[model samples]
Target: MNVTLTLALFIAAWALLDYLKPQFVANLEDNILSFLLAIITLVSFGQVVARYGFNTGWSAALEFNMLAFSWLILFGMSYGIRTRLHLGVDILLQKVGPQTAKMLGIFGGLLGAFYALIILDGAVLSIVGVDKEGGAITYFAKMYKVGIGVEEMKYPAFVQEMFGLKRPHVQRWVVLLILPISLGLLAYRCLQASWHIYTGQCGSLIAGHEAESLVEENRGALKD
Candidate 1:
């Protein structure tokens, strides 16, 4: 469907931006996450203040918080990988020689990249709701065809009128748009890490030996 094609184009455009202006891409990601957190925090705080002070609160506050949290989590995957925050047990790497560990680390990174691709394809196929991939209509297409909007999350009246939509609520498909995008970012980070390891730029995958480093940093303090 056109919706899928458009989203795919957006993904490609994002990849291009990532290639050409990596710092801008990084700033964009950080800003998005920060904005989401700000929204969640402000909405939650307003709800609490209203409820306690005036015995009235926004009914949609909880739902809005949930939405913001979901977006944060979906988009945070790549950030975690980019910062090497996603750690794993490196027992085998520890036991092996440095060269062997390096290879194993590269293999692990490739595995992560493969896993991201698998998830991305599976999500697209599941959302498309067809036996096969090509020539299939996506769930977003179907939702648009029916023009169903989400519950408790409303668009501004002007937006509803401008779009000529029957309902004021935001669409479900729009909220879920982050899924594929997040997975794409995940795959890119994995491959990037793999390449770095292969080129002797990064030491290994999965932020190895973080606990050891933390312990070392605080060792003298504990004794004191």
Candidate 2:
């Protein structure tokens, strides 16, 4: 598997262990995953420092890292909403029996699947647009002025123009791929949730009705 899929599977495994085992081994695995994530983040920071230099200091680094982190959270929440893991009123859901709850869950998953499919289509179109543009935003005249009199040595004048403008080439392309990939993942998660719901495993696959009941029951006992 690619590194991204491997990390995604590792996260699912951690989520599984957290739900099923929730014991020492799972806790240890969680800690190991956390450590690996931290190490990878640090390595990413090192790469940035090596490429961008430390001349910009901590504030710039913090701003850059915060932007990346914000994207991560934004994608995660997008996926969470598709999976119905975003907050909702569960009191009514729990008041109904498992059959009704499961049906509602299935309905929710179907709705999410429809939404994810729309996002997936949009993502594909966006990727196609990027491909058509060759990942560059160049006007025809802007593309014409960059050559130093070398025949057939034309280039998109962005690099030169950015240098002229004293602006940085902040390679936002890597981040551009984020949305499509996240949408694809979100679609997969919705399908997974749908499968679990159909197979009567949604209640166990996620901490849903059972968790709400436990919390409510605990709160009532405390009141008593």
- How many collisions per candidate? 0, 0
Cα RMSD for predicted model 2: 11.8
- Give the TM-score of each candidate: 0.81, 0.47
Model 1, poorest ten-residue lDDT window? 130-139
Candidate 1, residue 78: the lDDT equals 78
List runs of model 1 lying over 4 Å from the truth.
2-8, 123-146, 214-224
TM-score of 2: 0.47
Question: What is the per-residue lDDT of model 1 for residues 125-210, given as tens digits with 9 covering 90 to 100?
Answer: 45447443422124446665776777898988888888897877888767767766777777777888888888988777666686
What is the C-alpha lDDT profile of model 2 across 1-224, one tens digit per residue? 14335434754664566458757643563464465457549857775786688544333444445555655654664445433556655666768988887787777766665665454343333533532222111221233333223222222468658566332434343344454455545555666677777896555224456556778879978888
Q: After superposition on all CA atoms, what RMSD does each candidate show versus the true structure?
A: 4.5, 11.8
What TM-score does candidate 1 reach?
0.81
